[model samples]
Target chain A: GQQVMQIPQYQHVQEGEDFTTYCNSSTTLSNIQWYKQRPGGHPVFLIQLVKSGEVKKQKRLTFQFGEAKKNSSLHITATQTTDVGTYFCAGKKHSGYALNFGKGTSLLVTP
Target chain B: EADIYQTPRYLVIGTGKKITLECSQTMGHDKMYWYQQDPGMELHLIHYSYGVNSTEKGDLSSESTVSRIRTEHFPLTLESARPSHTSQYLCASTRGGSGNTIYFGEGSWLTVV
Candidate 1:
């Protein structure tokens, strides 16, 4: 079985501050996906990282995958009030089809 | 936006009652999944289907059962509901490809008394 762990279960920051959440897996992953869930809403896909040591950016958000494919991180620069939500990382093993999800990091921004 | 639909956005039922959460996706995806989530908690996989007549239990142990008779429909049924069963259920589907994005439904909020 594959397991994914995320750090900083909860974070509260002032608007325009930065935030980061790290994810680690027990085994190497074939691919990893990030998701965001707003208050009272379902999870929405944010980005997916497939190649090892890959870095992808979307607006103010930046995603990075470890060279070993066993860790990932999401960093948000100058967070806004609209960034309040829980970010989850899901990892898929090389030999499995199911995606094992981490507990997630909840972000709260104060305006 | 995804074309996935979940019925009964909210449900409040008494204990021992039977209920079914209906999930349907028009994207013709072969992979469908059901996840349970609590307030401020992580998403827990409950059940998933690869295709018609294929069903598998997820990492989390759940009392619910699911059926995949059609490619578009994957419904979860609770024969005897309890308070512990109260949680938000989300239905999602993926097109089955490398780096495929999963689309989730709005979710069904269930509360058992």
Candidate 2:
């Protein structure tokens, strides 16, 4: 079975600070996806990285996939209250069928 | 927003009672998944289906069962609920592909007393 490990189980920052969450998979992944879950709400898809060493940006957010395809990261710049939520990284191994999710990183931004 | 739907956004029942959480999607996705989560915690996949009449157990062991009679509907059932069953169940669906987006329903919160 494949497992995804995430770091900094919890994060607290000021509204203007930057935040980053890293994910590492036990096995090489074919693709990796990021999701955001608001308090009391279901998770919503944020982005996906397929190519090794790929980088994608969505406004203030940037996502990167490691060159080894076994790790990924999500970074947010100048966090705002609207960006408060749990960020999860899920990976699909090259030989696996099910997507394995990391224990998400909970982010809290204070004014 | 995705066209996925879930029933009884919240529920509370006594132990030993049977319960079913309904899920449906209009996106015509071939893959559907059921995940359980505690408040502000990581998601644990309990079950998934590739399509109608096909189901598979996920990484986490669950005491529940699921049926996929139609591509648009997938329901999870618990034969006998227990207090440990209290958690939020989320239903999600995605099209066939490696990088496809997963659409999730609002989720159903269940509590067994």
Candidate 3:
């Protein structure tokens, strides 16, 4: 069975501070996806990384995939109140169709 | 707007009652999934369907059952509800390709008394 683990289950930071959440998988992944769920809302897709040692950015958010394809990270620069939500990382194993999601990191930002 | 939708956004039922959570998607996606989540907790995959008449249980074992008679509809039914069944159930669908995005419905919140 494949497992995805996320670090820093909970985080609280002041506005303008940076936040980062790491996700590790027991098995190598063919692709990894990141999602954000606002309070009382369903998860929303953010981005996906498919290549080894790949990096992608969306505004103040940066996502990275390890060269081994076993780990990924999502970093947010200058946190805002609107960024308060849970960040989840899901990984699909090589040649597998199902996606295994991490426990998710809950982020809380205070102004 | 997202094409996926779930009915009865909130539900409260007495114990031993049977209820069905309806999920529908208009994306014409072959792959559909149902996940259960607690407040601020991880999303656990309960069931999934690859296509019409093809359903599979996910990593997490659930007491609910699902039917996939149509490509656009996948509904979960609980024959007998209990207090432990209180949680949020989310329905999602994807285009079925590597790295493809998964779109989720607003979710059905159920509370069994």
Candidate 4:
């Protein structure tokens, strides 16, 4: 069985501050995807990382995949109120294609 | 956006009652999945299906049963619901090609009393 573990179960930051969350897997992953869930909404797809040591940026948000493909991280610069939500990392396994999701990091940004 | 749908967005039932959560996707995806999540908690895999006539339990052991008889439908059933079964159930599907982003339904919130 594969397990995806995320760090900083909960995080709070002031407006214009920076935030980051990390994801680690027990086994190597074929790919990793990130999702964001609002306070009372369904999870929404954010981005995906496949190549080792890969980095992708979406505006002020940056996503990085570890060199070993077993870890990933999401970093947000200058957080805003709208950035408040839980961020989850899902690792796709090579065996069955089933995704193993991390517990997620809940972010709270204050004004 | 994905065309995934779930019925009875909210449910409140007594213990020992039978309940079924319905899920359907029109994206022509071959992979479907069910996940359970508590308030402010992590998402846990409960069940999944690769295609029609294919079903498998996920990492989490659940008392619910799911069936996939058609390409667009995957329903989960609980013969005797218990108070511990109270949680939010999410249905998702993936195209398995190009972008591997998983699309999730609105989710069904169940409260067993």
TM-score (all chains, Cα) for each model = 0.99, 0.98, 0.99, 0.97
Candidate 4 Cα RMSD (Å): 1.1
lDDT of 4 by residue, B7-95 (tens): 98999999999999999999998999999999899999899998999999998899999999999999999999999999999999998
lDDT of each: 0.96, 0.95, 0.96, 0.94
Question: Which candidate, 2 or 3, would have the higher lDDT against the true structure?
Answer: 3
Best prediction by DockQ: 3
Ordered by DockQ, highest first, the candidates read 3, 2, 1, 4
Q: In what order do the candidates fall by lDDT, top score first?
A: 3, 1, 2, 4
For each candidate in turn, the interface RMSD (Å) is: 0.9, 0.7, 0.5, 1.7
Candidate 4 stretches greater than 4 Å from native: B97-99
**Model 3 over residues B1-113: C-alpha lDDT tens digits?**
78999998999999999999999999999999999999999999999999999999998899999999999999999999999999999999998978789999999999999
Q: Residue A3 error for model 1, in Å?
A: 0.8
Tell me the TM-score that candidate 4 gets on chain A alone.
0.98
Give the CA lDDT, 0 to 100, for residue B45 in model 1.
95
Q: Write the per-residue lDDT of candidate 2 for residues A1-111, one digit (tens) a residue.
A: 788999989999999999999999888999999999999999999999999999999999999999999999999999999999999999997766767889999999999
Q: What local lDDT does model 2 show for residue A87?
A: 97
Candidate 2, position A52, lDDT: 90
Lowest summed lDDT across 10 adjacent residues in model 4 chain A is found at A92-101
In model 3, state the lDDT of residue B109. 100
TM-score of 1: 0.99
Candidate 2 residues lying further than 4 Å off, grouped into runs, are: none
Query: What tens digits encode model 1's per-residue C-alpha lDDT throughout B1-113?
Result: 99999998999999999999999999999999999999999999999999999999998999999999999999999999999999999999998865688899999999999
Model 4 clash count equals: 0
Which stretch of 10 consecutive residues in model 3 chain A shows the poorest summed lDDT? A92-101
DockQ of 2: 0.88
